[model samples]
Target chain A: MNKILKSIYMPILAVIIAIIIGSIIMLVTGFNPLAAYASLFIGAFGTLPNIANTLANAVPLIITGLGVAIAFNAGLFNIGAEGQYWIGAIVATWIGYSFKGLPWYIHIPFALIGAMVAAGLWGGIVPGFAKAYTGAHEVITTMMMSYVAIYFSHYLLEFGPMMEKGSVPQSPLIKDSAIIPTILRNTQLSYGIFIAIAAALFVYWLMYKTVWGYEMRAVGFNQRASKYAGMNVPLNIVLSLSLSGIFAGLAGAVQILGVQHRLYDSFTSGYGYTAIVVALLAKNNPIGVVFSALLFAALGTGSQYMQLNAQVPGQLADVITGLIIFFVAADKIIEVLKSMFKKQKKEELAS
Target chain B: MKEILLNPQLWSATLAMATPLALPALGGTFSERSGVVNIAMEGIMLIAAFFAVLFAHLTGSAWLGLLGAIVVGMIVAVIFAWAAVTLTADQVILGMAINIFASGFTAYLLNTIFGFSGTPTDTPMLPNINIPVIKNIPFIGQILSGNSVIVYLMIILIFASNYFLFHTNLGLRIRAVGENPEAAETAGINVIKLRYLGVALSGLFSAIGGAYLSIGLLNSFSTDMSSGRGYIALAAMIFGKWTPFGSFGAALLFGFATALSMQLQNSAMSKNIIMMLPYILTVLALVGVGGKSVSPAADGVPYTPKK
Candidate 1:
């Protein structure tokens, strides 16, 4: 229990520090930090509509974050999540647009599942080399594949048969029947939020409750030992990668069905990439993934308000995020933790 | 065959496209060879591109812009080195963070300085410098004579890098640190310093490549402009097995792939599939070179002195 507490202490403190620093910076720039933050808080959560918008953005992030978290826990850095997310969205959009007469329930699930399967296959290819070859690191492979996936998706939208002729690099819109119904009236928030939650729960169960999960964690902990212990190391690797890909794929699907409702080149901009940071921030936990996703969604969603009201560029949000990730990942934070522990011990003695 | 042999424009275009990638790939090779995975090449390039244009716009001199790129490149590289070397952070994460930072910061800078969102302050970009005697040669002149100074610098650097890697004592020490830091340490080498230098040098050269893209090539900075070329250079580094000349070959191939795509896009007949060519060729190259790529022994894993 103490060990778990120790692991989380720094991250929590970092968040506090970041908020304090952000507010100070805002104040120095001649804006009221309190008002800015108040507006930010209210803008994100003041109304049902704002909440819905926040949740809508959070849904895709949650799925993509889980995808990244799964891979990270398996000792694989799935930098290709962005690519997988793109491919997944592309596949889901393709399915949603192509199939005409299906019922909403069937069509949505079918489209989402198609996305998962497609992205899974895309991810599966990376681990194949890693498993078969003695020294293939999936990091480089995934990074390379991310580009392939992005460019491939972009090209597909550009000139492939799926592309809308005479359009500049985009796919035809899906039929209305294929769209995921929005939960709230006059909002982009869709039933996709529920799917994202279900995915988190599903992953939680898979990672914590299943035998394959045990084997996967074991393999991740020590590949040589797992191989020695008769575990199919290669199979676990491929399985983990596929599972991670599925999460990213689902993220893509949600964006199409819930938000854009069309397949467009570079549509899902940096979610896949940002999901890696989300996964890290969450410490690769499914529940943590949800909250981190929300935080990111809030930042992204809140930035528009910042841009409109404060004159701070919306890109400031990205800078803050980058700063957060940098500070969190610096690993020198270990020193900070030790100092914090020392201070706590001194306070306890004083008391 | 006769037509192919007579095509000076084709050769010039290939050289133009290839030079930018080649410089960065070679730069990346040096970094990886010294046991640091320099994925920050893209970010460095982006900053260089930004400053390259910024300085050119300010001074109206492309030479000053090129110098600015090298300076800004070093600054960013130093940041990366500080994080990866001193802080002992995960190199990959640091690289990713740098890329994200560059994108966001550049966008912010674009708005703050230029009062624009997408493109930076537009001014005259670097002009091509025509060599007197070299310009007079038939096919060779068209291919190599009149181009950016950075292109010439890249050609010179390739030979210089090759000689430095194999011929110099300091280069030998850097290679040793990469191959086996413990052994290098035993031999009285400051492994961390060497790695930092390797990475920093990579940044310097990559900046040249980036400057070439903006000032010498595009003559303008756009949002997210580096566009995975740094990552592509990383791929080339791996595909070439971390050798200066090998990466040069890989760089040429990657450049060819990109050049071919651009060529196809311009050609009236094959414009439809032009976008697909670079990606298809990249995938093919990856497959062809699968599992054959090797990094320096200590790449990505931080080197810390045992307590």
Candidate 2:
């Protein structure tokens, strides 16, 4: 219980503090934070559809956050989840639209595997090998790769071979057989939620139940020690980052198959970057990612309603998200505050 | 190809594009050399760009706007420094947080202050200077004479930063602390203060880059108008091997790629493909040269002075 509480405490405190700060910003800017937050809450969970939509929004975050968390476990920062998944989406969309006759089961799995391989190669193999062989920083390489992927996606949808017959720069809609069935008709939620949950479970298993994970975590903890122990540190780095890319690619595949149904021009909902914060808030735990992703998705889904009702901009969600990351990153201040309060209480009792 | 090569406009555009990237790359050198891996140049450039437009609009002077933005950027750098250096938080995470915050805050403020239409049309912009004697020189004159004032300033800063970083006692001390904070501390050098100065300098330079985008090049602030130039600047820094002149050279190369793309916009080749040039170049450059450029030892480690 204490272990779980300790894990949960910091994130909860960070969120509360961030929200308070966000409220103060709203107040200083001459807006009523109460109304904005109230509407935001309602919009996220007021009705069945709202709840469903919130969960649906969380699906991609859960998957991407898991990817980031796994990378963190290996002491790798795969900041290019954005780019990895962009490549994945492009590949998945192409497979979904172009494949003429496969059933959903075969077609979906095929697209997913193909995307994972392509994206893993793009996001993982190059950077992983580069970092392993040459001492190149994955942070820089991954980030650069992301831009390359983003611009390449635009090329495909806008003017490249993937562009459909219309004047608008949108690809053709994925075939009906490729679409992941929604849980309920007319609802945004899909079985992709299950995929996200499964991915989390799979990550938990990989990290805790397997020797591969043990070695990977060991490498992350101390590379020199791991190397001394005869573990292939370089290979682990490549494997860990590649797995992270696979998960990122999986996220793109799921989103394409489930929610979007087609690739839009430069379709970035920023799930990639936000996944970093989600993983951070979760302390890089796979199970914790689910809840963290949900919390962020709530903020995201609710932002529109808050905008409509409270005359607040939807961008406030990003602000709140940023603040949460800040609080989390500088969490030493929280410990100081907590200890300071304890000292005060001790003095008060003595008095 | 001949027509494109002959155009002085392309050369000028290369310098113009290079200014924003070079400034940030140069700024990143100071921070990294002082042992802080500052990925926050992207965020700094963004926030500074927004504030530059806001202050310029309010004061009716672009120069005042630039001043206001520098103060704002320095303030942000101080906050970042507090997190990275004082609190010893993860510098990468702190930098990412600042970038996200800058993006959100700028977008929110832009909407609140400027409305949906965007920044005021009459918002002041830094003037393009036409050097009197230089304007008369042939092709070289056209490329160098007519450009934003900040472009010239960036060139001057490159040289100044070189002299400050390589040829000065302060520079040596900063490098010493970065390479070995404990050793520097044992020698009675204040590591924390120097680190703060390095980070603050980064903020100053990044602010210039951000302002170059919103005011120096364009007259208005748009959402994420700095785009990924800050990241590109980061690539430039690494490619240049973390030296001021090297970063400037890398930035010039990237800027030339961008200029080439701009020139190619008229050609039959797709525009989106052209846009990928700089990013692709960055990836290739890192692969080719990034391995050889070793970072300062203890570059990202948080220093806690032993009592």
Candidate 3:
């Protein structure tokens, strides 16, 4: 119980601090912080529809957050989640639109699986090979690859096979068979949230229960020691990245199938980048990512209402999110203060 | 393609494009050389570009705008330095946070200050400096003259940094700190001060690059105008093997690629395909130069003196 509380404490404090700072920023910018915060809360959770939209927004973040968390556990930074998400969306859309007259079960699973494989290869095998064999830093390669994927997606959507018959730069609607059914009658929320939760559990089990997880963590903890202990270090790197890619790819697939139902230029909406913050805020814990993802999703969903009702800029949400990351990333400040307080308390007791 | 390659105008365009990249690439060289991995160049450039235009617009002086950008950039760098250097936070995560902060804050400012979502049009741009004799000289002059003052400054900075980093005593100490902080500390060098200096210079140079993007390359500031040039500059820094001249050369190469694509805008080739050239080249460059480019020995590792 103590361990669980310890794990939850810092993130809760970080969120509170972030919101306070965000409120200060809003106040400084001439917006009513109380009104903005109240409206933001109301917009996110006051109504069933609002809650549904927030959950829908969170589904992708949770999945992508899990992706980043898994990679972090293996000591690999998978910054290419953006690109991997795009590739997955592209593949899923391609398969979604190409097939006809297929059963929903077969068609949906096929498209989603295809997305996972393609994105896994792009996010995992390609960069993994470079890092393992050529000693190229994955950080640089993954980031560069994201640009490649971005432009490539643009090219495909604008001029290639995915382009709709009209002038707009987007794909035709996916077949109904491939669409993930909405769970909420009047909102965008779908069964994808369940999939995300299941995936989180799977990740938890993989990280804590599996031998491969042990080897991967060992390599992450100390590559030299792991190699000395007869583990295949390079193979673990490849597997860990591949596993990370699968989750991010699934995020793309779910988002497209459940929400957008079409492919378009730059359609992933920076979920890949935002997932980094989600993973960090969650301290790279798969289970923790779900809650963090919901928090961010609430902020995102609430910001639109804040803009319309509170007369604040929608971009305020992003600023708040960034502040959250800043305070969280500099968490050593909190740790140091805590230790000082503990020492002082101990001294007083001794006296 | 041949005509585009042969056009003398292409060289000038390439130089103009390359100038923005070279400044930040050199800045990355300085910071990384001092053992601070600065992936926050993107964010820093964005903030500088935004503030440069804002100050220039408010004060009616491009020079003051440039100064404002540099000052703001340094302040941002100090925040990063305090976190990454003093607090010993994870540098990469902090850099990422800064990038997000810059993007969000700038957009927010644009809304509140300008009251519009589009690029500000009335802002003044920096004047071009056409060297009189050089402007009339020929193809060489055409390639080198009639650009913004920042372009000329960037070229001069390359040489200046090359000299400063390799030949100066301060440069030696900085390198010593980057290569081995404990040794440098033992030698009585103020490793923290040198690092602070290195990172500050990086912010200044990247801010110049950002200012160039707003007032030099384009006439006004738009959202995300820096695009991915900052990342490209970083790639150039790595591809150049973290040397001043090498990074300049890499930036020039990328600039030429960009110019080539611009020249091909009139061709039958798809514009999207042409747009992909520079990014594709960056990836290829990283892969081709893999295992060959070595960074500073202690790059990205926080330093703590022995107790």
Scored by DockQ, the top model is 2
Which residues of candidate 3, in runs, are more than 4 Å off?
A335-351, B117-120, B266-271, B274-291
Candidate 1 versus the native: TM-score? 0.91
Chain B TM-score, all predictions listed: 0.89, 0.96, 0.94
**Top-TM-score structure, candidate number:** 2
Give the range of the ten consecutive residues with the poorest summed lDDT in model 2 chain A.
Answer: A154-163
Candidate number that wins on TM-score, 1 or 2: 2
TM-score of model 2 (CA atoms): 0.97
The number of clashing residue pairs in each candidate reads 0, 0, 0
Candidate scoring better on DockQ of 1 and 2: 2
Which residues of candidate 1, in runs, are more than 4 Å off? A1-5, A16-39, A131-134, A165-168, A333-351, B1-7, B58-61, B117-124, B266-291
lDDT of 1 by residue, B26-125 (tens): 8887787778887889888888988888888888888898898899999989888888887788888888878887877777677766776445446667
Give the lDDT of residue A189 in candidate 1: 94
lDDT of 3 by residue, B1-307 (tens): 6776778889999999898899999999999999998888898999999999999989988888899999999999988988888878787888888888788888888888888855568778888888988889878888878899999899899999999999999998889888999999989998888888888889999999999999777767777778878888988898788889999998998888778777866542365566566566655565564447767888888987665
User: TM-score of every model?
Assistant: 0.91, 0.97, 0.95
lDDT of 1 at A83: 81
Lowest lDDT 10-mer window, candidate 2 chain B?
B266-275
**What lDDT does candidate 2 reach at residue A284?**
94
